[model samples]
Each structure stands twice: as structure tokens, then as C-alpha cells.
Target: MPVRIGGLASGMDIDGIVSDLMKAERTRTDKVTQEKTLLEWTRKAYTDVNKLFAEFILRTRESFGLTDSSSGFLVNQSVRGLKWIRRATVGDVGIADVSARAGAANGANELTVTQLAANWSAASSDGISAAGQSRSNLASQFGLTDEDVVHLTISTGTGTKEQKVQITIENGMASVIKTSYGAGEDGEDSVISLLSGKDISDLSLKELTRQINRADIGVTASYEESIDRFFLQTNQTGAENTVSFSDE
Candidate 1:
């Protein structure tokens, strides 16, 4: 048969066929690089979400008058990676878990931050009771408030005789209010009795967080149990990554 070339069976263009194969290989490589880039972006999105969660937890703890101790829930994730090969879907890199106390003081305490008066000042007289008028007026003039008072218990030495007292405030106003019963069997719960007649007002949740942050409580505010994922928009051609949300 006479030599034939072109139209699918051209053994005449073997080199050209090889060149075309190389071009296809390069195209595949480019696609792989694109997929990798997408994966990295998605991973970063997950990390940012977790960081935000941490910040919120810290802020919440500080607002609740937990300055001496760090409070709030801590979360972590496991098993994060690309789920889909074609569209390049990614999953949370780790297992999601919370860090909270195992018992009693378990959950987050919802409270706001307020300024504690340095002394018996006038500004602290906002809600003074009738019997507290004279003292309240004097405290207001000097810039003291009720929140400054921290109740404590004192022992009388020879026996376990304990007495409840408000040390931070003036000596006589509401200090050393004994909690013992006449029977001498046992004293009233000193802490409870000290706080029985006290009235406390806390800032709203939102305002409390603001105050905590303002005080530089060393903790940031963040959202917890949030969903961090992105969606790919489908079009006539195919699907591609779109906007991503790092929270629930």
C-alpha cells in the first residue's frame, strides 16, 4: 500500500503526537497546582474561625468577674483535609471539642464588668437603702460604692468561732455581722448571711463584654461551636469555590 499520512492514523507525525501528550501533561499539572492553592485557603479559613472562637471565650470570662482565674470554653478540631478531589472540598482539620470544668463551676458565667469603688465614695450610693442613707451620702462624696465590699470570715482563736464581716467597707457600717445562733450549735453560713441583705446590679451582657475588653482583661472575645466552611457555586461549566464562613 502507498504511504498514508494525517487523519488519526498518521504514523508520519509521531513527534507531533508526543508534543501533544506533553502539553496535556502540563495542563494536568496546572490543574493540580490550582487544587493545592484552593486547599491551603480553605485550611486557613478553618484556623481563623478557631482563633475567633478563642477570643470570644476569653472576653466572656473576663466580663463575668473572673479576673483572678481564666474562664470560658475552649474548642479544638480534628481531621481536617480536602474531601473532594475534583471541586476541592475541605473539612475541619481536627475533632471539635470543648475545654470546660468537669464538675460544679462548669458552664460559662454570664455577667458584666463594673468598676469596684476604691473607698466609700458618693458614686457608690446609687441604690443605698433607707438605713444606709447617711453612710451612703458620705461614701458618695468620697467616691465609694457597694461593689467594693468583699465579705470574709474571721476566727476567734480558742474555738472555731467564726464571724462574718465586710472588710473593704467602713469598719462599723455593715462589718462583723455575726452569723452565730444563740444555741452555739453552729453559726449561720457566714458567707451567705453576709450577702443576704445586699443588692447587686450587673451590667447587661453586651455592655459587660465591652467593659471587660476596655479593662484589658487579657482575654479576647470569640464565638463557639461555629461552622467554618465554604460553598462552591455551580455554573454551566462546573463548580468553583465561593465565599466561606468560619462560624455557625
Candidate 2:
């Protein structure tokens, strides 16, 4: 005997199947939303990591004459495993000298840089005498107008027991000479203050970094943070890379 199922009975089963499908679709939608949230959370974490690294580096900064409140800080999120980018340094003049002479005093008196160091004491001396006249004037009789920059050396001799070199030509009288062994990079603030006319307080980290990098400071650059780090990097590798901060 053949038993046929009626349309009403089948209808009920079909409705249940439809409902189940709808529920599956909603479940999938929920899963997608959760995944998106996780992604957002990861992004925020990365940003936080970058900020942390930047702050660490800033704190460790050895104060190489930075004045800007926001300078010397940087982060590059795209760079994996603790990478950093630094701005270039410009206006880094290794040597600068301006005296009363326009060109070398004379052919024979030409002072070489190498020899300048040995004769620095004599060159720094000051006395009022004639420049010399008609070749007959005695060398000592004439004013000691001949100044030679034999050499420029830095030393550490500016403590209580230490000594320095100072000279002045005023009122036709010469004072006792003192040699300066350049005090171990101490008193640097005073040196900076002594420089006038230019705003040493206002410096461009970007330009300075560029100059240093070009000079082969061996630094890699990236933007882990929004702004740039205002300095150049050194080429020190492995454990030698102390200037950059770690992401961990």
C-alpha cells in the first residue's frame, strides 16, 4: 500500500530548513565581525608598540644638544623587529676659523693645518707691534701681526687643578698665556653660549640627520611614529647598535 505525505506536512519541514539556513548566515556574519575586531585590536597594539619604542629611545637620548621638545623621537611600525629611521644632520662644521687676516700672511708664513697644533700656543699670543715696513723693520720691532693656525686639537684641561690656554691683545699689553686642553666635552653649554648671532637653540633635526647619514653614520630610517626622528643613525651593528631602541 502507497502512503502519500500531504503538502501541509511537508510545508512544516521546509519552513524549519529555511529557518536553519538563516541562522547559519547570521552566525557567519557574527564571525566576520569578530575577526574585524581582532584585526583592529592588533593594529592598536602595533601602534602602542611603536610609541613605546619611541619613548624609550627618547629617554635614553644622551642629550647631544637637542632643544626641541619633540625632537629625537621616532618609530616605524612597518619595520619589523625593531627598525628605526633618523633624520639627517646638517651644518655640522668640523672646523671653522676667522681671524684678522684675509688670506695667508705671506708665502713663507703659510700655516699648514697639521703643523698648526704644535704652534697653537705661539699663534694664540697677542702683542701690539707694527706689521712690518720696507723689509728693513726688525721682526720683533714690528707688531706680531703674523698669526699661524698650526693645528687645532681638543683636550681635557679645565678643572680646578687643570689649565687652559687664553690670550688677548688689548691696550698694547700682552697677558700671561694659558693653554686649554678642552675640558673633556664638559662646559659644552658655555661653548654653545659663547657662539653669538645664530640661534643655536633652534636647530633642524631633519637637516642634521641628513648630513650625518650622508656622512656615513650608518642609520636606517622608517616612520614607526607619525612624526620623524630628528637625527642621523650610526652604522654600528649587532650589539653595537645602541642608539636605536628595541620594540620589546
Candidate 3:
């Protein structure tokens, strides 16, 4: 139902007057809107701080491998020579897991080491592997273009940890930007935020080398202009440190 009120007889601009009156009422809405915006900002700040703290705790845990929990030592099956053949006697001393009580017999044993771990490695296409190569030239060398993607995947610790970084040119800029289109599960801002917004065409080989080194992925990239070659090597030698690449 619509309310009908005519101000014809009084010749009053009722609608205009009401509109003017309503202007003051909008202050409530405006205040609410402002408060809502402030609340959002407060929430964002709290959330960001919380996330940063969470990340700090997680990294600390991973680095030290320590926690507020009970722990025990258990040798894995890989320890071949550690299998106890006989109990240690009271007068024997060797690498043996046994219990010697009052007047109990004791024995001795030997231990041996066998194998070592190795890391995996891979190289990018030699087309873009030249020293002092510009990023703009990379598209043509790798058969990529504007808005295309180049993916680099690094696997560590038998796939327990893996990071994939997706790269693309910024809109209306020749600089680099971190994108989510093909980024690995844990490879967003942390792994590929280096050299952000810097034009690749303008960045020298030495500068690119610096950025790659700063990525903290336990790998180093160096360019040798004298031989027109680029090399990617792992900081640690182990088969678990695998590197792979793709472009689209």
C-alpha cells in the first residue's frame, strides 16, 4: 500500500521538504558505513598479524624439529647391522641393545655404514640460457608470449616438500608479478616475490642472478656470458632435491 498525501491546497513542496529532512537521517547510515569500514580494517589487521604469528611458529617448529610432546628413539629397518644376535654380558662392551641384570651375561657387536643420499637436478632450455639475456627475449626463446606462464617446480625431501612458482608479466608493464594461476600449493608470495615489477628486458644477467639467489630455495643460478651459458645447481647434493620446468 502506498501512502497518499497531497500538498496542493497548501502549495507546499512537501516532497522537497521531506527530501531535505531525510538528508539528516542519512547520517545514521553514513556512520554505520564508516564503522563497518573501520571494523573491516581492524579485522584485517588482526588477521594478518595472526597469520604472521602462525607462520613464524610453523617455521620455528620445522627448523628445530622440537615440540611440547613426548618422544622416543626407534631405529628404522634400514639399520641392518643393529639387529641384536646375543645379549651383552656383564664384562662386555659394544654397540648392542640389551639388558644386563645382576650376574647376567653381556656381549658385543659392530656397526657399519653403507649408502649416502643424493640430490636431483635439471636445467632450463639452452635457448634462454645465454648470459645477460633479457626477460622480454625469454618469451620468444621459450615460445611464450604476453600473459603466458612459465612454471618452475622444485621437490625436496622425497616429495615431503615441494614448491611450484608461476611467473607472468604484469599488466601494462614488463615487470614480474606473483600469480596464483599455476602456483604450487605453498609457492605464492614466499617463493616468487623477488624482482617484483622490475622489467626483465632491462635487468642484466648479474641482477637476475641476484634475484634467483634470493629466492632461498637451496639452489643457485649463475650465467657465464663468456660461454653464453646459464647453470642451475642445488646447494645441497641429494636425490630428493629435484627440479622441473614447464611453460605455457
Candidate 4:
């Protein structure tokens, strides 16, 4: 330690002067620290803005590419050639409605309908059960037993392009239904388990209809309680659209 001569020789306030100098130094240091913090925040803001601009540029390039086939605005290397508008008119609006794509011909075309297309449909030859009977009664009427295993195959489409869905029935309950495509396709089977673990006796006619519709088998099934018959129809109207059923 050094001996401090406070106003002994100079007779002035030396300690007060030193304290004032230290206060000035502390103020300068605090100002530098504040300036450094402001600079860091400014740098961060610029980085965030640059990131946003980069993303926007990437998306714009993808959507507006001249040669990009997936770009909706470009068609055959010409943006004006893109088909984005079309209009159609029907003579009899009540009979049918018509629509045309933008790529269709611009001139009006006359069409004559000799016969309307019909959807393939079938109904049970006889009543499945008496009127006002519960859906559970169908098991007995169809002669289904808990020990019996019934294999039901439903097919759609025509000729070589047909797709078949097979449903297995056991213990008066239907298992998962799987559909496999025909030749020239992947032949991968898609499985739908709408009736899995469900007892037929516990389901109502409406509930059964809902389950069958959700199966997406290209067929719709309905039960008419008034006529006591089950009806099945193809979901689409065309010559190629057909629905067939075979059970054993």
C-alpha cells in the first residue's frame, strides 16, 4: 500500500478530484456498452429480413418458371396460351347441365341424345325379411350360422380392367373387405374394415347402408323396409361401370 497525502502538501482536495475522474470513466464505459447492444440488435434484424426475402424469391421462381411443367401459369412456353376460362350452355336446363374445360373448342357443338346412360343395378329376387323386422333378423333369413364362413366377391368395371373385392363373413359378422385391381396395374390390395368386429344383429338397416357406402367399393347398397328388399347399384353411370356379386 502507498501512503496517501491528502491536502498535506498541496492543501487542495486531491481525493475529490480522483473520485470525479473515476465517475467520468464509468459514464464513458456505460455508453460504449449501450452502443454495442444496439449494434447486435440491428444485425439480428437484418438477418431476419434477408431470410424472408430468400424464401419469397424461391417460391416466386417455382411458381413462375417458364419451362416448369408443374407451374400453373406456364403452358407450352406461353403464358397467354394457358387455358383458364371456358363456358357451356345446355338447350334444356331441366334435362341436364353441361360444362366444358378451357382447352375445349371455342365454337358451339350440337349434341343429340338418343338414350341416357344408366347405372347397372340389381335387387334381391325375393324379400330378405318381413316388413318392420330388425336388421339382426337378416342373419336367420339368409341362413347364416356362426360356424359358417361365407365368401362374398363383388366386382366392378368390365372385361380385363375389372377390380374385385372379397369380403369374408364369419360368426354372423363381416370381416375386412379388400379390393385388388386387374391386369396391367400394380395389383396392390386396399383393405377397408368397416364391419370388422361388428355383429350384424346389432346394426340397423341405415347403419349397414352407411358402412357399405364408406367402403368405397364403387357400389351403393340400400335396404327398403317398405318393400323388404335389398338393392345394389353402381355408383357411376356408364357402359364400363358395372357391379356384380357372387357368394359361397
TM-scores, all models, native as reference: 0.23, 0.24, 0.37, 0.51
Question: How does model 2 fare in lDDT?
Answer: 0.36
lDDT for 35 (candidate 1): 100
Show where candidate 4 strays beyond 4 Å.
1-90, 94-111, 130-135, 141-143, 158-164, 180-187, 204-206
Question: What lDDT, from 0 to 1, does candidate 1 have?
Answer: 0.36
Clashes of 1: 29
How would you encode candidate 2's per-residue C-alpha lDDT over 87-189 as one tens digit per residue? 2222323433333222223332233456221111112133222344222222233323335111211222212323322222233322223232343466432
State the lDDT of candidate 1 residue by residue for 79-189, as single tens digits: 122122112112332423223322324234333436432211112223322332332232432344664544433222113323222222333133223333232547335
**What is candidate 3's lDDT per residue for 94-163, written digit by digit as tens?**
3334443334445454555366555444554553553443444443333344465334443323245554
Worst 10 residues of 1 by lDDT: 229-238
Candidate 1: lDDT of 151?
A: 42
Error of 3 at 236 (Å): 2.3
Better of 3 and 4 by lDDT: 4
Candidate order by TM-score, highest to lowest?
A: 4, 3, 2, 1
Better of 1 and 2 by TM-score: 2
RMSD value for candidate 1: 28.6
Q: TM-score winner among the candidates?
A: 4
